[model samples]
Target: MRPRFVLPAAFSVAAILLLVSCNRGDLPGKKQLESEQVQASPVAPVVSSKVVEELPEAAVSPLTVEQRLEDFDYMWKIIEENYPFLEVNKRLYGEDWLANKEEYRNKVAAVKTDDEFFRRMRFVLSGLNNGHTNFLSKEEYPWFLESYIRAGLGSEPWVNVFQQSNVLVRYNQKPLTEQQQSPKESNNNVNSGETGSKTGMTSGNVKKVIIEPDQIAYLGTRSFAGNLMEMDSSEIRDFLIEVKDYKTLILDIRGNGGGNSSYWRNNMVPLLINKPITYNTYSLYRGGDYSEAFMQARRLSEGLLPIANIKDEQMPNIPPEATTMFRNYNKNVDIVTPYQSVGFKGEIYLLVDSSVYSSAEGFAAFAKGTGFAMVVGGKTGGDGLGTDPLVAALPNSGYVFRFSLQMGLNSDGSCNEEVKTVPDVEVDPDTSKPLLDQPAIKKVLELAASQ
Candidate 1:
């Protein structure tokens, strides 16, 4: 649920053209800059050059205690001003944000090294209990590549290979003659030629269309991050078109950590339902003077940007009074119309697991709430709380951190934060085996065949 006003480059160009052509009579006056309150620098007493040389190099390092304090203060101010879930977090976690800040500031003052500073910052962020929030230091950037790879595959290298090979063998019930990788398994491998790879192995794979004995079509992906529309236009479209003749469809997203929601909205949902639907009932933003200014800038740049293109009658008309407050600054209700070209109209089964998070959780929620699919597998990782997180950099250490400035609500008007989406048919995976070997998928196959 990224801001609609944050348009693509081409869209921004179009908006600029529109802005230039329109009258600027309604634009707000330029804000006056407040007078700066400058703090006086401590004066250095005259000292001998020889005394300075005698001091240890470690004592004169750039990342001094004072510098770390300054960094922490900067971070604290930003979160205090912008974090959207302050009240919701208090209700959910009993968090006293101001108290936590005071406690953490004391800890920051005690930090003796750069590593300690980073660790303490991470500890403070972890207290939020929001998976979307994280701090990544400059030194940790290189670690991201390795960590990402490990996250996709299991941390244990041998276990990942064994699990993938075992799942394939078990599902097909036949030893491969060539021991070659299937497109789905190949897609997961870092060495594979694909440009971008998404998803961890939490979800089962539906790489190649496997038509079971009773005309059940199985389609699996590890993630929902890439250009699914292009994938659909090419191989997926061909597969779905072929599968339209099948009796039932099983869409697997077992290990998927969510990506962009548009992949499902624009490419998948249209193929499933014949009519328009409302998925997201409402959304809330952390509004303040800053947010108001931000929204005004966006509105000026991109006038009345539509979140989704639904029929006129289907749109949720948000009242002007609702938009007046800080929390409701950019709040919106989303209405999605199905893609008109999709023709599949059969029983749909969705496979989910703890790895399914963020936008993927939204999919599971929508499907379950709308009775669109019979959800199977373990409860999905409930991470649909905050929309897109806003990123900021630490002034001193150059470390980057992200925090969500908006909280989304379910169709029932409940906050999505920390609310796990349970499956209709629960199937726990065997710890010793791959998720694909779990009875959940087997049950889906059985149910699909019956349908």
Candidate 2:
């Protein structure tokens, strides 16, 4: 049971979906209901006979009302069933999503063009207020779809519509079919094509500096996306060798929006720590079409999430699925760290800010909870807990959308997204400077030196 929060008066979409729900009609019986309920086609969704060679052509000629209806219904159904944050959003933001289904469906009905349709869909999803649950931006759509292909969703029939993409390929400056590079291996900037992880956002590149000549050193990177360590293997290797015996190290992640967790887990963590650091946490999944298909497509097993058996009282206000996953977690989803040949015997401090999010936030969570590091700086951007996002395609346009499948919970049962990691020692960052050069980072260094 969820706590009753006073809802804000701005809700437009509700939970009762008239378009998605089946109509029982004047006579209510099993035979009549079976005939009236829409069934998924064995071959393909009902689409036009004409092939859309260029996506822009399809854009110019907006999909018919009925076709758009199918797409809208597809997205809504997926959200209704699999999205874990609906209740969470209502509790935190006072937007009751379940109370406005008819309004959302009407907005979909009023869409005249695909661009407008996309923006409107964005409008609808934004109501959820989750950094992970919202729809992708126009620039982010194609790259996300290409990513799904690697996850084995390419076999989907609607995915073929993306193969012929023209204008959609603008972000990476490469055709979707040709851009099969892995997130860690490929250059997606920050897993997108435009602004780079280490290159974009005016955030300083991945670099190591010896502030007090090896006694105190600092290393900062913008994203865990892309192969940062591998890209600078020799330099990083030499830096680690020089600094492993250092007294104190400051690991700064201020502007990192996130990418792959493995970038830090396997690449970053072990090189500094002497022994494994086990971080116990929960991973939540709302079993449904997208979750089921994603599970199968990725060739994963449900048993992967160890049963938690956590008490409802332990977890405060959060999504039920999050608690359910926690209580049923088979094993702790710990960030089991490995011992390194070159380890830092000195005290390590992690520097973070609101910009540090997603996988970056996960790192903050792990460090704060496991005593892996003395976490300092500002509060994180949150939404860091969870598995990779789940993918879905609008039937008419094959426009792919994604949201989180798993909810991340801290060891104490607080939702990672809601109860973001708070710095043990709060130091205000001088916003005018880069991450390493920030006065707050300097203050932390001073504190470490004093100790």
**Best TM-score among the predictions, by candidate number:** 2
Q: What is the lDDT of residue 304 in candidate 2?
A: 52
Clash count for candidate 2 is 18
Which prediction has the highest lDDT against the true structure? Answer: 2
Model 1 C-alpha lDDT per residue in residues 8-61, reported as the tens digit of each score: 111121111100000011111112101122111111122111100111222223
All candidates: TM-score:
0.62, 0.72
Report, for every candidate in turn, its global Cα lDDT versus the true structure: 0.50, 0.57
The regions of model 2 sitting more than 4 angstroms off are: 1-60, 145-204, 227-229, 304-309, 312-330, 335-339, 434-437
Tell me the number of clashing residue pairs for each predicted model. Answer: 7, 18
